[model samples]
Target chain A: MTQVVALSGGIGGAKLALGLQHILPPGELTVAVNTGDDFEHLGLSISPDIDTVLYTLAGLANPELSWGRAGDSWNFMAEIERLGGENWYRLGDKDLALHIERTRRLNAGEKLTGITADFARHFGVLGRVVPMSNDLVRTMVITDEGTLDFQHYFVERRCEPVVKGFAYAGAADARLPAQLQEDLQDPSLQAIVICPSNPWLSIAPILEIPAWREALLEVTAPVIAVSPLVNGQAVKGPITKIMSELQLELSSASIARFYEGIIDGFVIDKSEAHVAPEIAVATHVTGTPMKTPVDKQRLAREVLEFARSFGKL
Target chain B: MTQVVALSGGIGGAKLALGLQHILPPGELTVAVNTGDDFEHLGLSISPDIDTVLYTLAGLANPELSWGRAGDSWNFMAEIERLGGENWYRLGDKDLALHIERTRRLNAGEKLTGITADFARHFGVLGRVVPMSNDLVRTMVITDEGTLDFQHYFVERRCEPVVKGFAYAGAADARLPAQLQEDLQDPSLQAIVICPSNPWLSIAPILEIPAWREALLEVTAPVIAVSPLVNGQAVKGPITKIMSELQLELSSASIARFYEGIIDGFVIDKSEAHVAPEIAVATHVTGTPMKTPVDKQRLAREVLEFARSFGKL
Candidate 1:
């Protein structure tokens, strides 16, 4: 009867979320997705991280790729091109429909939390998928190349810019979504898992909400973080590149240091077992490459077992 | 050297605009498009009237239809269906691109006039396609069913609702686009042609602007109007049905009366020749079935000839 809450962004975060979903009961796992990348494109409210996790968990995500739906068509993007629009973000026809619906619902004054809940129900996702906040919080990456929007730095520019730092626009006043706050305060809550998402770009924005961070710290549950970087290289995204730009060692050790005062435990990939000694909190190693459903389930079970060993229940 | 300003909406309006484009010199024809039907769908600021006129003037309009581009694909709408978005608006992929770019520019604080100017220049439209006003003036149809947003009545519901009347939201504060007013006041201006678009739906909204009607009356140049209704039926859109539901006679003669104080001359289709005696203004018959490029040019020439017959110039 353990209630597990997992924080995630897109891609690497979704991998670990899939694992958690496999091991947790239907109502046990609540996922809080980053909304920093949400922007109005082509008049659609596109929450890239939420969609990626939703697609991944529904078993509809492209098996080879971390983002977008599998077997999706480019008919819509091609047509957008014919109309002389920028197609750098690579929205598939099926994906475009979700964005359109989300945009429509959002414009009609529905909260992002409610929209996410409806979308999860529609997609038949067994676990809850919640946006970090209902407020607009765009991640602004201040790079040596100049201040760039998150998508511009990641998708449009292909993450080639040298990062100076990052700022969460609107995070100063952003409150945790009611659903997320309620989940954090639930009596059944036993653990919080920080998934393998980019520390600064993804998870930091969610944590920046004062109430969100305060609620996590106030909770009695053990907070654990899984490594996105293994053996000095990130599994996906610009985590390692950003780490180097910020003059930090790109390893599980650095990952632990990034969340030093926040997390109670650090989970590293088996390949980076040597760096376990340098990580401060209680650490463990297990199969962390969540390539298949079986791998996801196995990792989920391992994380749960490791949490139980901390003598909470 | 005559500066001709043609006020238009969709389809039939585009046809007359194409004709004007053929007859007028570059920069001589300023086409004021209706923005009453404009609404944000999927976060795209869609100016349907402006796009129709732009595509028509550029020779990119569908030959068989007066709206949208030729060979347009529904990939965007199709994908929107997959994501469970509103499919009623039926945005083609290429059409969505126009909306996306327009929305992007709009969000960036660019004026609707400048965005449209860029779109017109990009599409190779020789005539200027100016929005009636930079402000958002939405047309709301007060129908027997309910008050419906312009697109909700026109596109989504297929204009089936019984019409009571209409009102332009935001018209009280809407001023003429500065450049449009400047062009209208130019000494080279000779005549203003109101294209064969729906009077209540298209033209009424433009006139509803606080000082717009005054401006139209102040200009001494003969203001001519083309009838949308012929033989008691509208060539396109909901003009005939709307007229009948509002207790107005569903004919070209009634159309002239509806525009009574505003116009000095009226152009009717050959099909409406029998009803010429019923019209208040001086009326003439011309081929108004603008189903092709030739039809547009021919109609434009006829309207110009009718204007010249006044003998003031």
Candidate 2:
């Protein structure tokens, strides 16, 4: 009857989140998704990470794209491009329903947490999905070109810009959602799993909110992370390139070092287990690449078992 | 070459507008579409009448529905409904591109006229398609239940409300688009054709603008209207029901009387020619049912020929 909380970003995080959802008992898992990449595009409020988690958990995610809805059409994007609207961030036709409905509810004064919960229920997601905060916390990448919004850098620019640094705009004022706070304080709370998403781009935004880090420190539950890097390369996305641009060591040791003070344990790919001696925390070497549902479930089981080894569960 | 300006609403008006586009030389026909029905739904600015005119003129309109794009898919609406969002308005997947693009440009400080014109050109529409004005002018339908916004009354309520009257919410301050004003004053302007859209819902919103009426009266060109009612029934929409509720006689003569002191000619269906003598304006009884492109062109030719009898063209 252990309750687990997972902090997630987009694709990679969503994969492990899906894994966690499948392996965990009903109502035992809760996901706090990054909203730092949320932006208003073409007048619709688009929450990229939240939608990825929703689609992935609901089993509606496009397997080929690893984002958006399955069996999705591109009529909206094609027509938008024809009309000279920005088409860099592709919005699938069926996927647009989520953005439009979320935007409508947000404009109608509904909180993001409530809206996300409602969407999860509507889509038949087994576990709870909550936004990290109701308030704005945009991730701004200070690149060589200029300060670009997270989506502009990651999607529009295709991560082509050399990263100087990142700033979590509005993080100073953002409060952790009450749901997340209450979950963290629950008596049965056993573990906090940071999924294999980019540390700086995904997990950092959640951690940058001062209260979030403070809350994690206060929790008795063992905080653990699955490394996004395997053999000094990202399993997906631009994490390796970003690490190189920021002049950080491209290794699992670097990831462990990044979360040194917060996490009690780190999960890295078995191929790179040699670097475990340099990690400050307890290290678990496992098969971390989640290509199939079986892979996700297996990793989820391994992570939970690893967390249990800390004498909490 | 004669230049004609047409005032239109949705479906019916779009039919006649399409006919005008076919019969008139390229760039000779300009449509001033009613924006009173424009409302923010799902956070997207939906100019229904403007889009209808654009789709009809561009040959993308559905012959079956006469409103949305041909071969349109309803995945967006279906998904929106599944998500518990509003589905009564029925925005098709392809049609949503127009609304999303327009909403984006409007938020970017572009005029509705410019955006619409750009869309028209993008869609390969030869004739100009512009909104009646760039400013907001919502049509509020006063019913026995209470006042309802145009879309609420027409789409959500299914035109079931007992109509009392209508109020153009922002008509007093709305200015005619510069393009419409310039077109009206051009020496080559020979006629202003009022298409067969519901006078209460469509054309009236455009005509309700005080400056619009004043400018129309000052023009040397003939002002003509195609009757929406035929033989005590509407060719489409709720014209007959609204007329009965408003205590007006259900006849083509009543339509002519509605535009009294504004129009110099009225085109009605030949089936109702017996009531022509009661009309104050010059009545032209012809085959006005535009079911096909050829039919639209024929009606357009006849209406133009009838307008020329005023000695302007």
Candidate 3:
């Protein structure tokens, strides 16, 4: 089986990652998740993207919320509010266990990668899930409201602030986890898939690591990116809003251009297939909206087959 | 109205504290809870005794469990067990809010006394509740199984270890909280009630503070202790087993003798009133088993009236 590494962010990326996990053979998929959104809340280390990927792959994600655990209880949050603690970021009772355990392990001098892998195994996830780096790389949103932490801007403020730019604080000191390096350098590596998550908020943090971009440029495997934009709007979250705020055109062509130099192929929604000619890379049009498990697997299969067309499989 | 102070531990102490809260006028009772059993668990600062007192006084305590909040959910604990995290402490989802909020405040440089008082106020507790000291005063049980922390000895091990002796790890440096000092020195102070918690496990931690004993001896207010034992057996917990292991007679007289010169009066169960001759202080016999809210109030009235009989009121 050819090994594939997927770069993922949160909900949108987790949907595609889950799809990839279903189609690939056991242990064939490695998801390098963005930890830029990780932050300490109430003394607990919370890795939002990593948790979303884990929950999605393990089939424990809440169907309605698109995050958190299924049948989750809100007893903890209710009591926190009563105690006058900050409750803008909703934490489910079951989901809180992950944050508490992760924080405990981290405080005890355990590496984030090892703790994530242990959690993945315990959750019975078939594919490997690893953080992009062990060191802190906080994603700071330089908004009109001032510099805000990723979760503060996204969850607490509800993405209300106008975007100026993003700064990955501590990225200069960050190094790619050894597992991700091994996956990237594997002899049986097929293609690197950038899942349909926000390019600037999700994928950019992983690519911002100096060594990561260099490694991707050096690898023989074709680098493929799936468009988060489906016509001119994001399937979910604030990609379209951010693009408009940054004065960038909300089109698949723009997304493909964002990954211009490194990407060899791009996947976009079939409705916007006419823009394929404008993209310099080889483009494949497919149904990209992942509303169900079948939709996820279908899109995943199409993306993989598109990567294979480059003759690198 | 006579102002009074109570020294408390966990469940057993909490029951009597709840009774006192119900009987006394608002702001007339101040509980100085032992912090020796407090420990960091899952990266949260958990003050078990303080929480129990708060919950009981606020009428939010679980009637059956005698600890934690009523109608609590166990989703946190269940998920923690699934993740292979420590599950011995059994933190309920609702109860966890207190620990999380308390830890957050403490980490942000807020004093534990202020946080606890705020929490009590939030919970609508009428009487004031304060920790014995702001400093860490961990209770260490030196048993045949070696030195174990208080919670480890009680909750994790189920009090199975053979007792040898006990030590307060940080008692030498601990001082009475300023609020407690003020309450003790108040001109309107009538009596100090020692709740019917284990002398070895609960009350000992608070009393072990050198300043606490010295302050009690210097105060003019009568000091009254309620016996935890009834018919040579503790109503709850391992008080009897610990007493026998420590080579002491399992009798109410032993508990009264344990307090010796510090207590001016002692309250015992009507069945054990015959042992009054062995105790030098004034003894009052009452129905001390509190199984209902009415029973708590009745015991509270009895204990207060007993204190009044010393002519200090």
TM-score rank, highest first? 3, 2, 1
How much is A19 displaced in model 3, in angstroms? Answer: 1.5
Candidate 3: which stretches are off by over 4 Å?
none
- Chain A of candidate 2 gets a TM-score of 0.98
- Please identify which of the two predictions, 1 or 3, would achieve the higher DockQ against the true structure: 3
- The DockQ-based CAPRI class assigned to model 2 is medium
Worst 10 residues of 1 chain B by lDDT: B75-84
* Candidate no. 2 TM-score: 0.96
Q: Per-candidate TM-score, first chain only?
A: 0.97, 0.98, 0.98
Give the CAPRI class of candidate 3.
high
| Per-residue lDDT of model 2, residues A255-275, tens digit only | 898898999999999888999
Give each prediction's DockQ, rounded to 2 decimals.
0.31, 0.78, 0.90
Q: Pick the candidate with the highest DockQ.
A: 3
lDDT, residue B133, model 1: 96
lDDT per residue for candidate 3 within A39-103, as digits (tens), equals: 98877899999999999999999888867999999999999999998898899999999999998
Q: Candidate 2 clashing pairs? A: none
By DockQ rank, best first, the candidates go 3, 2, 1
How many Å off is the CA of A304 in candidate 2? 1.6
Residue lDDT tens for model 3, B117-173: 999999999999999999899999999999999999999999999999999988888
lDDT, candidate 1, B80-151, per-residue tens? 665566677777655666776788789889999998998888777889999999998999999989999999
